[model samples]
Target: MADDQLGEEYTCRVCGFRYDTPTWDGGSGSHDICLCCGTQFGYQDTVLDGVWSVRAKWAAEGHQWSSPEFRPPDWEPGTQLAQVPDRWADASVLAFKLSAPPLPAMRTSADPEAQRAEVLGRFLRDGRLTHFPATGREWTIVLEHIAAGFEPGVKYRRLEIDKLLKAWHGKPADLLSRLTDQGFVANDDQYYWRAER
Candidate 1:
């Protein structure tokens, strides 16, 4: 899909709010926080499923203005949502990857902790993982770190799961799907939680 489909160049992917600047630039999010749904463009509103989850939450919460200072007196949710392009509304998983910047050369250490730290340093930014690691060992480490965020015995609603994973990666649904497939998380149709694997 064209990044600016339907003349939505400055539109919030999550709430469809128009902004002065483009939400995405050169395949990366502008990282501007949305005034309507409060979605941080590069973070919570990155992928399609994640965007949908944010929209759903905003709607469920009565469509409150995220930035009350900028909210117009006559603004309505239905009208703004109508501005969201069909590309976002009709899609399932729009796995849009923000361009991953190149990292410094690294050497694996003999110490397990050091090796893990190196892997994390390459993949994480401000506690949020930038992308899935290419190596199996590094990927498993990242997955385990993410799984640690959830409690083992407590069930989570789908929205709750999405929220928890939102800070971890842009593609929460994909992350959950991978976690479930690997038996790190289990779900019984509706509820999900960390599995005792």
Candidate 2:
């Protein structure tokens, strides 16, 4: 079936609003309800609450709807875009540090020690560290030591993992294990290389 035919109709379960396949606004697909009320009616409206809600949810989830011509829906031509501050623009690259690492299936707990063990097990399974030093004060030491070998701006080795774990001293091992398990780095004979997937 054609794409337009597939998504041509939508009905509001609450209000029983119904619209034709092709709306006057050239909306790709017709919705199942009157845009104003939750009821299904046989017409289109200038404003659609259901459509707006879906759009808002997509934006909140950091997604954009697919369109042949991509542009901000409400933005008009000749409106100058706002300039991003240099510091703010630079900070976007650092946002990856805020993300949780990908690890194998393991039970996580509110208890910090249990979480640490789970993360460490994942790390040992997925990561290979050539050098295992004794007498560790904090797991941060290990992460920093591993991060030391990579040069800045090379690739996946951002070296911010240590900084990110600074706030959670008791959970540094968990954080380190997560990073290693995620394949952010590879240790070879005391030297570390950034692992890119």
Candidate 3:
């Protein structure tokens, strides 16, 4: 089916509320309701909170319904954000770290590390990395912050690691593992210290 027919992440045209409603009614008719505001458009607003299968469109000016006080429905317990992996650095995983590695070059001039840094800066704006285009230079770019602020053998906490790898798009474990495999960082129990010479 068409993407629009399958529904979309729609924002209420009246109250500016968002809902995952389809643009088309299955077979009978529209049954959409805005959970945010009590606005029913071709929907029975009394059943199961409300039938949410109505389509919204642009009126001559806009929607005529007055904006109601938005009340978001409660999610089912344990059904929200279950895949996030609760990576918070509370009392579980005390800290994390990565070691700096020297760039290797046996041929013509080309700073792989610098290139990685530039790419990361372009993709991860403002120290946040929600999504980025896949590229072959991922690990190289992740290595940019290696020697900048990290000191060898220092047991830095997860907060520090978060700052250093704020722009990295991969899981923190993978980044740490890569550094350890490359002999850059050493795993001392739970802390990641720089591998000493």
- The Cα RMSD of model 3 versus the native structure comes to 21.4
Which candidate, 2 or 3, would have the higher TM-score against the true structure?
3
- From the highest TM-score down, the ranking of the candidates is 1, 3, 2
Q: Tens digit of lDDT per residue, candidate 1, span 1-197?
A: 56447457577777667754577775777555676788877888767788788887887899887656456666666656655765676332122122222222223468998877777777789989886653346666788778988987999999999999988888999889778876789999899989997
Q: Across residues 22-53, which tens digit of lDDT does each residue of candidate 3 receive?
A: 31243322234443333453344223223221
Off by over 4 Å in 1: 1-107
Pairs that clash in candidate 1: none
In the order shown, the candidates' Cα RMSDs to the true structure are 15.5, 22.9, 21.4
Q: Locate the minimum summed-lDDT window of 10 residues in model 1.
A: 95-104
TM-scores of the models, in the order given: 0.44, 0.18, 0.31
Q: What tens-digit string does per-residue lDDT give for candidate 2 at 1-197? A: 64213323332221112222322224432222223232222332224544344433433544432221223344321110011111211232134324423212212267767655544443333244422221121233445534545564444323454544444343545545654764655554334355553
Please say which candidate is ahead in lDDT: 1 or 3. 1
Sort the predicted structures by lDDT, highest score first.
1, 3, 2
lDDT of 2 at 85: 15
Q: Please identify model 2 stretches exceeding 4 Å from their true place.
A: 1-170
Task: Give lDDT for model 1.
Answer: 0.71
Strongest candidate by lDDT? 1
lDDT of each: 0.71, 0.35, 0.38
Candidate 3 wrong stretches, greater than 4 Å:
1-114, 130-136, 157-170
Worst 10 residues of 2 by lDDT: 77-86
lDDT score of model 2? 0.35
